[model samples]
Target: MALARQLFNRRMMWMLLGCLVVFGGIFGFKFFGRYMMNQFMDNMSLPPATVTTAPVEQQRWQTRLSAVGSMRAINGVNVTTQAQGEVKAIYFESGQFVDKGALLAELSALPETAQIEVLEAERRLAERDFKRISALYKKGVATLRELDQAQATQDQVLANLAVQRATISERSITAPFSGQLGIRQVDLGQNVAPGDPVVSLQQLHPIYVDFSLSEQDFSRVKEGQGVELTAAAIPGQNFSGRITAIDPSIDPANRTFLLQATLQNPERKLRPGMFADVAVKVEKFRSVLVVPRTAISFAPYGNAVFIVRPAKSALAESTNNKAVAPSAQAPQWIAVKRFVKTGEERGDLIEIIEGVREGEQVATSGLLKLRNEGGVIINNTSPLPENLNPTPDNS
Candidate 1:
């Protein structure tokens, strides 16, 4: 009985030791988790270790709108044949630069020429007979009725000659305007019918840029306004133009108006059908405040920007009564939420129409870590990260 009691006691002691070990482990894990959470809070609550800033400078701000459109030629035409006949001669080659009234091609004019010659000879004979009859009638050798009949016959022949000459001219094809010609649709000796397209011609020196704007923008857009255009075909190069025409009436379906601009394509580099990025400056405000796009937080209610004030020092010398604290309560380290009315955006900078005033420094780089009344450190000496430029990868 004594041995059994000793064994039972030993087992009870081992069970007690196991429970204590388990309890200690649970307590340790709970304490460690709390300690880690506190450390994380301390780090996050701390102001951002570093930041970059830009001075809010006063400069002229332009309110402009941009749109995408396609380029077109100012004057373009498709040359067609007016007379149906066998192509006798092609005066201009395919893709030739032709002058106004220059002969582009000709139909078989032999038959028309022969008819003109016959009519001319008959007209001459008719005139001679009419003159002789008039003289005879004056001398009383011919009757008045005979002189009248001769005069009528001469007039009829002259009219016939004129009609035949016009027919001859119609057989020859001439360029109506000076332009560059496209590929020839017909070859020499090929029979062409009336209304058949001979070639295409376009004057591309002064090209046309056509873009549409909403009715809200139409009133602001005026004739003679300058436009800047860039094409994807020739990247980095901008073509300048001026608004030459605007539709007075708005399209009910789209609430937009068509705008036509004429650009001087001196190099003939801009081609029709190329895509363009068009910008029109509608208003210019002088000495306005401007901010980076990254600084602005666009929300449904309104746009907001966070301004950063300097943090206070805590050193004995720095803790003077006049010195401010480095906390949120400190006037020196403050986060101001300003609602800004934004205008046109160019690159990464946006034009501020109202709200935020000039010379206020805003938090730009570390927006993800910012709050309404969070503390911020202005490290203006450091450059803003290149990735901070507002974009989804333009390059």
Candidate 2:
């Protein structure tokens, strides 16, 4: 009985020891996790971290709206023939410059010319007969009906001559305006019908830019306003013009208004159908705060920015009591996350409409690692893109 009791006590003691070991392991793991978390928090609260920052600026900001547009000719048309005939002579060369009334091509009008000669002869004979009949009727030598018949015959012949002359003129092709002509579509002796295009004539001295503005911007747009344009086809070249027209009605489908501007393409660099980027200056704002786009932090709650206020030590020493803090001097830069409301954006810059004032510094780079009320050292090693208007990549 004593030996059995000893064996039972030993088994119980072994099970108790196993439970203690498990409990000790749990407590050690919990203590280690707490230590790791404390270390992480200490690192995050370091005195200063490097970041790029720029000062808030106040300037006369020019509000501009951008849109895509297309270039068109002031006067563009395809020169076509109005009558069907065999092409006789092509007087113009391919891609030639022509003036108004200049002959381009002529169809075979030989048959019409021949008929005109015959008509002329008949007209002369009828006129003579009419005059003779009129004289005879006045002397009572001819009947009044004969005089009327002769006069009617003379008028009929005159009408035939006019019709023949008009038919010949229809076979001739002429430019309707002064412009550079496109490639000729017809050759010598090539039969062409009515509505056959001979060539394309385009007046390119002054070109028109057709674009549309959103209905939200309708009230700000007006005729005679300045517009700047750039073409992706022609890089590094900018064209300037004044708004020549603004549509009186809004487009119900897209809720936009069509506008047109006239630009002088004197060098013939601008071509029809070229895509253009257009910017129209709406108005100017004075003493408005502006900041680089990099400084903005977009979030679901609201847009915020990391502003660099003076460290606790600097604030304590500052003469202005408004910047003072109750804590002791900590001699390091502080990053204060401030929620801001921004307005229009142009290129890489944005207008700060609210929640930020001029002369304050905002972190421009290294913002992804920032925390609210964190410490940041100002480092401006790299510069941000600063363009008032930027060209967009079509790709």
Candidate 3:
């Protein structure tokens, strides 16, 4: 009888465990479904997000090519001495403007000058002797050989004097052309060797600016085309110039076309080795739909934009009042994603080729909170940037 009671007690414990497991499973399944349905309904009843919008308008677009370049002097060189000698005197000061053929410095050539004087005295004496010999020979008192010897001595003395003068000229260094001089490198009374640099001369007027463009634009770029340049050193000042030269052969390594432009720098504000920014007008478009560059969103798939979807006639105008406090004066708009065919970007603005029209409005600032057909309200109190050619402010 005790054995039978033990089997019955085990069966009762097993039945109670099975009942608890089944009841918990049923309750948990119902709770999960109810919670998930609540979340779905909440997302469906979400209010429209506020976003800033701008109208796409037609504007005249002038295509331009931009490049970074460097400034160079029209004529620049380092002045050097031809002959090695001790500096005797410096005729010009450092950083002085000199003319062509003006003496810059003189080397000690005293010995050569003294030798010139001695040759000149000998030449005079030989001339007098030759005259006497010729007179004597004409009267048959002197031999032909004696007269010939006298003439040769006079010619030899004159040639020696000329050679001495040329030696002195080599010792004296002069400016080759008129230009502003740099600081002198050699000191007074210092011995300098041949080919040693003395000063640097640079012609500041009409400087040249060299820049490069892609080989694809080789046909559009030509000599005499106008270009504008600006330098960071001199702010707010723009220099205008024309294309002086274009390299016929493209750079095979970089596939670029090297170009040079000439600009008049009368004040000498533009200097050699300065960094310059260059712009050349390529072509113009009569009418184009443009928007702020910030309005477009770039993605791996393609470039896209959020266009304001029109109101539906079937939906009530007061529908926005259901989710959030809505104003009757404010127009309701829905965001619709569109892939656009874009053209060149002009500074802060960009050109839209297709997928949008002139009268359509686009979301500019609030792109983070948007979906394919998300509802939104248009608020343009803070407008997007409209600068077509924006530049950084250095100051």
Candidate 4:
């Protein structure tokens, strides 16, 4: 009976072990199959990305140098007082346009007026005595010395009266040039001393923009070159100007030269003290090689572009250079590492000064996924990824 019971326990243990193995296999197969199917479905449903491109063309490339600069007025004058006195009245309002010699401010002139009257009375008394003396001299009744004293006294009094009139004129402030007035710092009855600024005036019809160029650039720049400017206040609006002045001497410490441009402020919209972005057209290259900035893949070694050529030729070039493949699905591309010397960049277009020839298409789009000798599909769309509209005429 003991033998039979032991055998029965062993049989039950075997049955339990078989059931556990069957259940484990079923769960493992279901989980593994589901994970693999999900990955396969994801790969199948992905869509190809759309791309844009630009055909290589020959054109005259305008070399432009861009820099940050500030706007100034053609003639900005700070109106100040020459004599110290109490402000009697304000003649002009802030932001009011005035002509040359227009009265802008007036100081106290009551004391000056009284002094002029006193000098006039003294001159009258002196003149009466001088006339009487002159009559006596003509008749030989008065000596020459007495007549001379009276004449000198009368002349002195006349000079004093003239001096008083000139002093009164100085108390009134007048515009030195035709311009719009800035803020008035003082009101009536405010005391101002000599050299105190009364109001700021600026002639803005033809504004001036001041900028600095490096000594190397200054050597290449010339007067009458076309310049462009844009202010922060006026978005999307450009102002055109010409290089009016260039400094003869280069600053030795900074190796920069000062320059000025004259811009037309028609409508008087531009004001002084505004920050401006300036661009000067230095050179106009004719029928030059140009490329989109997106085409140039910059690396520590050099800058390169992908040329869409026949698959066999691209493979031969890549095999010859031994380049790594890119891990993305862009058009089949071949990396052509050319040492190109670049010129000025304007908008999204850059002038290829050297190492590129006309009529050769460079990759403007799909640059990030390009590999050496990879097959490339040409998509000729546009060269500029940004705005391609011609710049507005701000002349």
Best by lDDT: 2
lDDT of each: 0.77, 0.86, 0.84, 0.78
User: Against the true structure, what is each candidate's TM-score?
Assistant: 0.65, 0.67, 0.67, 0.71
Best by TM-score: 4
The lDDT, on a scale of 0 to 1, for candidate 4 is 0.78
Candidate 3 Cα misplacement greater than 4 A, ranges: 1-53, 62-70, 88-104, 126-159, 180-184, 188-190, 211-221, 230-238, 247-258, 267-270, 273-279, 282-287, 294-342, 353-355, 363-385, 388-395
Off by over 4 Å in 1: 1-58, 284-343, 347-395
Q: Where is model 3 poorest over a 10-residue stretch in terms of lDDT? A: 313-322
Query: How does residue 71 of candidate 4 score in lDDT?
Result: 85
Model 4, residue pairs in steric clash? 53-381, 53-382, 332-374, 332-375, 332-376, 333-374, 334-373
Backbone clash tally for model 4? 7
Q: Give per-residue lDDT, candidate 4, residue 14.
A: 96
lDDT of 1 by residue, 1-395 (tens): 99999999999999999999999999999999999997766544455434456656466755666888788987788888888899988888887889889998889988888888888888889889999998999899999999989889989988988887777777788888888899999898898888898889888899999998888887788999989888878764668889999988999998888898999997888988888999887776556667777788889999877766554332222322432224444334545556788876655677778876678777777766665455666667766532212334466
Off by over 4 Å in 4: 1-45, 283-288, 291-343, 352-395
Better of 3 and 4 by TM-score: 4
